[model samples]
Target: MITEARQPPGGGIGIAVRDLKVAYGGTRVLHGVSLDFAPGSFTALLGSSGCGKTTLLRALSGFVPVESGSILLGGEDIARLPPEKRGMAMVFQSYALWPHMSVHQNIGYGLKLRGASRAEIDAKVTSVLSILGLAGYESRKVTALSGGQRQRVALGRALAVDPPVLLLDEPLSNLDAKIRLAMRHELKSLHRRLGLTAIHVTHDQEEAMTMADEIVILDAGRVLQKGSPEEVYRAPNSPFVAAFLGADNVIAGEARLDGEALAIRLPNGGETRMPAARRVEGDCIIHFRANAVHFGAGSTRAGLRLAGRITQSSYPGGVYRYEVETPAGRFLVDDERRANPGEAIELLIPTEEMHVFPAGMPSA
Candidate 1:
């Protein structure tokens, strides 16, 4: 819990991070990172470990000092403000709850430190507990609660302060798979109901895609792209962004303008033609998700098709995934029907489903 800054009714103010840079031991971690978080919108900072996502979150929370940057909140610069004065609350990866304290006491700890009256603290804590569905657990020790209940206590504590902005550092990563999925819905609902601006940091792609209104994909301290989950996933600006967004199947080839279509000629002498937003030529890479690749030939053939033999197959519930070896290379394909290993199969990828990027260009 941080400052008690009131937001406008229905939503909090937006955050504008400009040219933010940070370093530890004279080695730069974040090199000129910038982003805008819409008011009341959920934005996820997504990237692999050591990509400076955590550093950026900590910098926004006033815990990590920036080398050169400005964090604008409500038209005011908070880059140099103390953590307790930033008008924001952060829920950490660990619940960070006091084991010895009761749920109510833990939720009221920040208020107590601020010299809030007992009556005010109790009221705020009680209200937050009810909102988090832990109304009756207030009197129980935090250690006695389940993992999900303890997480709610952490969230309740952060909400008790009524900060305009909430920062979550993989808050649900500590939960089991099932519990984590449940908490995702809970957090999304809570954010909407409270109308607070939220910035969530996570390495999980599904977490970001499911929870965020907008996703910022970062790598090596630089932002690769920032857009709605659909936009980034469907139309990545580069090979790196495409690959990072779960388009793991890639094929490198020569691309050229063939009439009104962008034609890609694979090394196997096959060509795939797709609609192009702009004219592009020369070497390029085609990226698509494993699920985008279909099995077998049909009346409606795909633009990119390859003949291959299944090297491995596994039934993962709804769909059977097959590792097919083709002229290009091995690729994983998801299909409804089961195909045995060593069986011949034709893999199909629709043109629109493939992400095409010029070779060696990592950005748009």
Candidate 2:
């Protein structure tokens, strides 16, 4: 556990990005992106590759030149400042540690560059090593460390500077799955303990959901949604957002107003009514996760009922996953019960788990 004496100072600074734009040659990577990071909050920039998530992070760190707009740190525009002068530290996706440097040297390189004395560097490195659970490995060369250790060294280097904000660019992407899970807890704990504002860029949805206080999802260089993990997952505003967030079972239907409820008529002559939030009275798309489906129609809930034939079955661990073929489309369903291929099954999807969006929306 890190003590108060070892905690980095001058944290809890807020950041605001306004109309930020960046381009690579003729292609604009960030299309007028704007967002905010509350003081001491951890925000994750999440999107598929080419969505400009990394570009946004790099722009904030001053690694990429901004084409237009401002990046405000603590209410001061730092968009024009150089990376070092921006008062932020970044942990790269490659770890970016010097191969010849020892752990202590790697962690203290920033301080040494700033003309700190040998004694001062030693003390700071020692404290940072302890905080990173690497106190005894100070003299070990970075090249000799394991992937997880190397990650810690990279993080330690950033933390040693004690900047008010930290930028992480998928720092755990290279670690093995088990180590990655463990590091997630460590990083979250460290962020809370240090109270530093953090902006993390990641393509992994689970990582963003688990580690971030807020999730900013971007698509095609545009902001799609910004909310807590649950908010975005539960109430996606568009078909693209819903599909990207793992609502993979999509069905096409036509919706009509049925009293205060919305009735969806499927091509297979099946109809279901769900409480309507938005008055979508036309062709629409409905999406739900595999786990949201049950293997029976006995439930007395108001939801979609689909008759499907199991085309494939596999066990990926705790549950059985089945690919069900229906008249509309093939859908993936997860359940604990074992059902063989070619077996007919009834899919029951609760109304609360269904996400309805108008047709012709982007599903990619």
Q: Name the top TM-score candidate.
A: 2
Best by lDDT: 2
Q: What are the per-residue Cα lDDT tens digits for candidate 2 across 62-110?
A: 9999999999999999999988899899999999999988998899999
CA deviation > 4 Å runs, candidate 1: 1-10, 258-260, 362-364
User: How far in Å is the alpha carbon of 116 misplaced in model 1?
Assistant: 2.9
Q: Once model 2 is optimally superposed onto the true structure by TM-score, how far is the C-alpha of residue 324 displaced, in angstroms?
A: 1.6
TM-score of 2: 0.95
Error of 1 at 194 (Å): 0.5
Cα lDDT computed for each candidate against the true fold = 0.86, 0.89
Please provide TM-scores, in order, for all candidate models, with all chains considered together: 0.93, 0.95
**After superposition, candidate 2 runs with Cα above 4 Å error:** 1-9, 258-260
Candidate 1 lDDT over residue span 1-364, tens digit each: 2122332334667999999999988989999998998889999999999999999999999898889989999879999999989988899888899998999899998899889999999888877776777766778999898888888898988888877899999999989999899899889877877788999999999999999999999999999899999999888877778888888788888899888889888988777778885567899888888888887576286568888999999988899888999998898888988779999988888887888877877632
